[model samples]
Target: MTNNKTILVVGGTGMLGKPVAQQLKVDGFNVRLLARNPEKAQKLLGDGFEIIKGDVDDPAALRSALTGVDGVHISLKGGPTEADFDHMDHIATRDIAQAAKELGVGRVTILSAYAVSEEKADTPESRSKLKGEAALKSSGVPYTIFRASWFMETLPMFVQGKSISLIGNQIHPLHWIAAEDYARMVSKSYQTDETLNKELYIFGPEAFTMGEAMKIYAEYAGVKVAPISIQMLAVLGALTFNTEWKGMAVLMKHYENWGEDGSPDEANHLLGAPATTLKEWCNKRYSQPVNS
Candidate 1:
């Protein structure tokens, strides 16, 4: 079916991309997915979804994918094993931006993480993401970039047996936004012309320090949440210096320097803040299912 809006989603099979694409489709936009593996995309995204086969690494494939699309949403990542494997985020972003410009695409919206700035892009991952953001900015297409805080999923990872590993001091407050909430914002970005050519920041409804956040989880899990020592974090950092484990340490180091909370009031006001409360989300996640 032909529609007034056509959006091409790169990395559509990914965690953030899937929800964003689904939300966009639900909002009456014609959504086309550009995935490296069309078979996998089909299996995950199901039928009646338009998908073109392409890897971001190939400029020719990107050119083919950009044709006839009104706008583009990039959900690509450059970190850890994937960064070493493909280098797609840094390299392919430029290619995609160029292709979008040449093809006369109207809008380009990128899903970027918070804490990325001109001075603080210290790690390889941050540097790469910044490059991608820059490429879209200079592409001359009206672009909307939303830098979001940590995801809700990150909380579960801290759970290890009876204790949780608190990266850094657990003192820094972080606004842990839900992926679903962020997806809604992304879907709205394409529909709203006001978002054009602007960079916005988004976060969860509530901001909590790791210690405070863990208390909610611990209460729900019926267990005590305790911090992992700075000494242990240091040891892990040393052991995993040349490996992907080091990346988490790098992130923790960054968090250690972040003293304040991420403000989401303005961004939330503009995009209509997500209705899910932290306690509500926790209850849904941790609560046991009723017996049939």
Candidate 2:
């Protein structure tokens, strides 16, 4: 149960998880990554990292993965939320916490979002993730919750080919952070014990309204897009499960009117730099090809 390798990365194959695991190894921590699909994990494998298949709900496998892990980094996302209110999101927290405790793991850092208790947990993913945080709090593992803002990379989806939805007049001062900045902070959080047992809000260096974000996208991608509000029954359907980014009710509640409150002290303190805004990230996203 003890070895030089002492970090378990759940969902290491994900866009964020892959970089996080890689950064951990570079920092001289022995890292093990758990993935359900070895093939996906294989594509993202970094030097000196180990991959194991895992199901978060399975108590035994979760415990096995935690063996000798000084802490756990959970990038685990998705769950059975079809009419069940994020079945895995809420349940997996308890399961993960139990496994970590059983394996004697002390610290856990999991990807969380800007979920207020009042926010809409109407879907399986949202509700489940919310519950998972509560479970971790009661699970007895010291934890750092990264209540991250929306990722700038997901902006393309909002365009929807040539058209885009302009809800709230595109005037909502939304906040987003580049995945790279978040990954870097996650690395710093792991190296610094000061972050242990605290939940932090992370966002970009500047707050850009939805309209501004779209303007950046249209300009950078060199595509023409206009804002139109299609407030119909279809919008309601869109809200149920968002195929496009704006459709999600949570996004509407948390973001569309999210406001420009400015950056938190910790956003500058722990990360040592503010998050990269949508405009800044657009430069990174379009200055080169995705494969590059």
Judge candidate 1 against the unseen true structure and give its global Cα lDDT, from 0 to 1: 0.76
Name every residue pair that clashes in candidate 2. Answer: 85-124, 86-124, 89-128, 90-128, 205-275
Among these predicted structures, which one has the highest TM-score? 1
lDDT of 2 by residue, 34-139 (tens): 7777666777684577776777866667777888888898886563234343545566667777778777897888887764344556545666777788888888
Task: Single out the weakest 10-residue window by summed lDDT for candidate 2.
Answer: 79-88
Off by over 4 Å in 2: 1-5, 79-85, 119-126, 164-170, 228-230, 233-250, 257-263, 288-292
**What is the Å distance of residue 116 in model 1 from its true position?**
1.1
User: lDDT scores for all predictions?
Assistant: 0.76, 0.69
- Scored against the true structure, residue 161 in model 2 reaches a CA lDDT of 66
RMSD of 1: 3.4
Q: Candidate 1 clashing pairs?
A: none
- Least accurate 10 contiguous residues by lDDT in model 1: 283-292
Candidate 1 lDDT by residue in tens digits, 1-292 = 2358889999888878888888888888888998878888999988767888877777777878889999999888666644652376667777788889999998888887777777777767667777878887888888988888777766777777876666667576777777789888988777678888877888776778878877776777665667666557657767767554566666677766654444566667678886665677777887742221
Task: Give the Cα RMSD of candidate 2.
Answer: 4.3
